[model samples]
Target: MISKFCKEVRQEIFFTWIMWGVVILGIVGVSAASGFEHTVTGAYARGSVRWLLGMDLYSEGMHGFLYLPHAAIFYSPFAVMPAWLGEPLWRVLMIGSFAYGIYALAGELEKRYVANLFTVSSLVALPMVLDSARNGQMTLLLTGLMLLATRDLLRKEYGFMTVWLVLGFALKPLIVVMFMLIGGVYARTMLRLAIGLVVMFVLPMLMASPSYVLAQYVGFIGKSSVATDPYELLYSRFCDVFGMLRAWGMPVNGELQTLVRIFVALAVWGVCYCGRRMWGHHLGACLILTFSICYLMLFNPRTEINTYSMLSVVLGIYVGWAIILNKQTIIGGCLIAFAVMIAFSYEVVHQLTPGREYWLPPLLTCVFTGYVLFLMVFDIRPVVKVDRVSPTQSDMLGVDAEKEAEGLVMTSSVS
Candidate 1:
């Protein structure tokens, strides 16, 4: 009966579409039902309007824009549209981008594997996707761009990859760390990336005065520095290693935190560099990309729950690979089940004990990330094995088929 059910699911296209439909409806439903009065995107929209009016981007007691001037220039179009229209349009675009990115990655797998991609991704990404949609956050869009960039990188399309990376960096400058991973593998891509950066920096000058753009950049750096201070009120939002340490009663001094983050990042990068040869295989390459993203999320000092949207992509990839490639079905099923539970950990904990969900969710994510890193380094093996065989005397006797046939005929005649 289980085999019959598996066969039916494999053959059904309607089920696949239904799964995708659920994901789309879920994103739209969550976005429309939630408040967006204080979102990252809204902040950008407000900042764009302020910039046009010659107002200071940063002011006292205001949750002013924290992004680069280029971000304001990008948000100007949405800023002009009324919120009623703009908000829905932005939500739809983010959802579409994320869906397309998942589809593109799924294209790498075989048809049998592709059918379950959306279902698994939706389950694993439920919390983060819903949170991003509800809060009008850029995390989904950033994740999509990063996935697109990874696809391009795997195809050896360095120029296009750089474009994707540049767009992601424009939205969140910390993504620039990805360039180091790319550069180590494809050194020549750095030239294209440099050009992209120059264009990104110069394009804002065309929209706003050079001096104004320069001032905004300076203001962003200064404000960002203050925001990253562990003692600052805003730092409570951080959910990375430093934040967890601080939450656990550790004396997380800013300087020490910076050093620790740098050391961890360097260690992860060294592992990647050492395993650079593994990129020749598809699974190895995916693992490397996923590891780099996981490292970024864990190491970045400013990460929050919204920032974890990127991990959904990693989870989706890992679950998909396990289902399609691993021989242990029970293990794969358990992993998928565990991932779903983790995805909804916050909601479950919140319902049982409100306000106590803070540490557990983030801590669980950190533990899961460590497990993923370990798998990337040690669990993955080459897809194909090299075989060495030497023929025995019996095998050698079989080599002369004509002689053996003659002998068999002579013996039959004697009998």
Candidate 2:
């Protein structure tokens, strides 16, 4: 039986869904009408032309294409179109992808919870949607790909998952971290991912000369290295641990930042190892993915606020699971409250402080995400059902007898 609190949460989620739709439509309409010129999409559009003409794609400053050369091949069709046509088309595509992602993720929830999926998801995603639309960022497309990947993962469709995951990686290399982490648990998926990467790399050579492709790759590496340099003025936009330390007046050079990032990654790897058994369980897998995605966003030196769009689907899943469990622990409540605060803190802080204080929200978000990771690692336990599994079958499946007795057995079924 559903509790009163759960019912209330569902109601709130339903309303949030309606509000999210209204907000998305409003933003899209405004963007289309305003004809924003200086957008990330515009940069990609321009970079596509440069790639075709064999011009220096990375010399155009921050607006230049940071994406791999093959990405230009994909964007060329749209780039060839006039801005009047391409900008609107791009906006429409982004908005459509965002809606599709939300819908797909919502479909993954239980029947009762599904209705609130978009509503609850918007709590974490609305700001990102706004930011992505405003800046013409690729995050909405990335978010959509991630949602598709997660949905396929839940359905045990590893082939589809690999396709979406690799596509996302092609768009942004940071998602490669997710691929590597998940590969540790599912070796077969990793093999498919390697094949997919090879295909993606080869497909671009058909459009550009081999030498041109080589140069593009070299330029990508060089520019990315420069872009992520801690001493660079653009590094101020970083919101990860490295950025937080730098913001607090700590002397963090590129070398030191890279070292700290490596240490943090090792720490995450250790936590994942310790929780390795949990991967076989539904809630446990979701929690691990949540922590991993948060880690990717928080540790990557190039991360910006819009990048949080990638967390939309995972955050929704985490919240839905937490609510379904009806856990009343103080720590759980505090985590939920803290997440909500972080979600809304930007507006309040912006009003109260100057523009330079903009870093506060992302910093607090990083801290909150870290706490959530800790809770998932040490505190959260998977919900298990013993009635369906006999002792013999449990033993055969490698279920820990002691953990099973404590109601911590992994289930084969996702829901």
- Candidate 1 per-residue lDDT over residues 1-415, each given as its tens digit: 4355447545543565566567666655655566555456768887788888866686543256777766776677789997767776777777668766776665443221223555556556665566666666777777778777877776678788899989988887767667677776567788999899899888878876889888888888888877666556324646676655555666467677778767877776666655555434344345456656677666676776667777777676555555544444664565565555555756775787565444444575676666655655674441311122123321422223444333321110000
lDDT of each: 0.63, 0.63
User: By summed lDDT, which 10 consecutive residues of candidate 1 come out lowest?
Assistant: 406-415
TM-score for all models, in order of appearance = 0.80, 0.79
Q: Which parts of model 1 have CA positions greater than 4 angstroms off? A: 1-30, 33-40, 60-62, 109-119, 233-237, 279-284, 349-356, 376-379, 382-415
